[model samples]
Target: MNNRKEKTFSEVWGEFITSQTAKGVADITIRNYHQVLHNISKYLDIEMTLDNLSKSKFDEMIVEMRKVGIAHNSIATYVRVVRTFLHWCKAENIIFIELPNIIERETVKETYTDEELELLLRRPEADCSFCEYRNWVIVNFLLNSGCRAATVRNIQNRDVSLADSQVIFRHTKNGKIQVIPLCSRMVNVLRGYMAVRGGVAEDYLFCDQYGGMLSHNALRLAIGRYNKSRGVAKTGIHLFRHTFARKYLVDCGGNAFTLQKLLGHSTLTMTKRYCAIFDADIAKNYDNVSPLAQLYHPKEKIKKQSRAS
Candidate 1:
């Protein structure tokens, strides 16, 4: 008789989380795993033994989610996370269920126009409050670097080296350090802000009014309020990243390879989306570089005539 013990789904999930934590996975990612499983439990028995798990049960749970009005994109996200967990289970020889295909649709990414950017970039008056001034600087940083809000929140004063014309992102999505150049213009702006903000090297670069580290929601709310005050309606802080990517590719003609590194994407998959979305950028000066357009520049215009015969 076979003597291997069968592990319950909950036991396996707890083990996976522990393993992932040991691998230094981000806390947010771990939290997402917990949340997704909890939501899945709403539709079916999430604590059943690994042997009872099957793709049919997953499909039924998905149907339940749809009936209850979960966004498709959000459902897609849950599928992705759960797939990772199932893959881990397979690797550990705990259980195996044929995974379903992940069908996700690409949505258009919105970016700020030059006019909107100009409005957000406007400098505050000399007597502006610290929060106002800080928000302005934060907007500038986002536009300049295209960093995520979490990365922005984790910045330390020492991470920015104005004299060296560089900024170091120590807390990236992939948990790696990313260093990017700081333009002289941005250097000057940060220099002025830091002088006024004044704190030790260990202080958060963009701290709360109380000189404490800024939280994620606080950062988003600050940007939202700042945008409304400046008369710009769109308030998604992540749009700054999208805007930066668009401007970097469409306006500045930056290539994808460098942008991939600049954006700290672990792969070209996401970067290629930006390229495909902004593919029209290739036609911006097509006439200037077209081989036929340049080659057809004869000394005299050529015209077609009736057959000589």
Candidate 2:
């Protein structure tokens, strides 16, 4: 008998993504894919072989994930990953099955109410340290610039052009470069940060105490520490980005396409998600206009004729 074939779709997909992800995907995202694939393979009893995977097997994987209490959103991510890989397999002339439908993603916009943001910004904890300052800057950067956390992690010293009042983001996930104009306050704050924590010319703007680049985990830990020290509710950085996008769209009437480009989203649908995030503001504006304000009152002549009759 011929020896069993050893190749698998999962193996091939992992290799392909590892080789090609550098061009369009961020380093952190590639790492995430590796972890996602690893866990998925372990969940299935059989090794992740190309010959064994089918639409029915994919369906079973989702059911298993749900049984284990994985959140629907997380399951959605797993489905997307498998779908993308399988589609690539089909394109590459490998084994193909009926493509599985993607798990529907729910839209939940987490935002800070204006009052809450004002309170957080105004009052730093009494026991605040450098970490509070770091959190403040991170929040300010995300809210003011609408930059993603990934871009924030990769922000380098050279990317900032203080004289021109612009920051260059080169390594965005969307494969486009953007120059974001900075307001005076942001420039001043950034200048202060740079002066206090100096790093090598090529190093990131946000660095550890030892002047090394700050990793995502370090930033997250710092934020956590700051939240604890300040006695504030825990919140992630993306909330700031959402706050920025919603406020900009509602108050400034920022164009959807422009906002999408600035946010480095690959599609308008992602930007449109933020439109709902500003629904309260939209409702307020709508309330200001009423048909009662323009409705014509009955004429005095008609009233006089009715009185005469």
Best by lDDT: 1
lDDT score at residue 90, model 2, on the 0-100 scale: 67
Clashes of 1: 0
lDDT: worst 10-residue window of model 1: 1-10
- For model 2, the stretches where C-alpha displacement exceeds 4 angstroms are 1-5, 8-10, 22-24, 38-43, 46-48, 66-70, 103-106, 123-131, 251-255, 290-309
> Which tens-of-lDDT digit does each residue in 184-206 have in candidate 2?
98888788777766766788777
lDDT of 2 at 277: 54
Best by TM-score: 1
The TM-score obtained by model 2 is 0.81
Candidate RMSDs in order: 5.5, 5.1
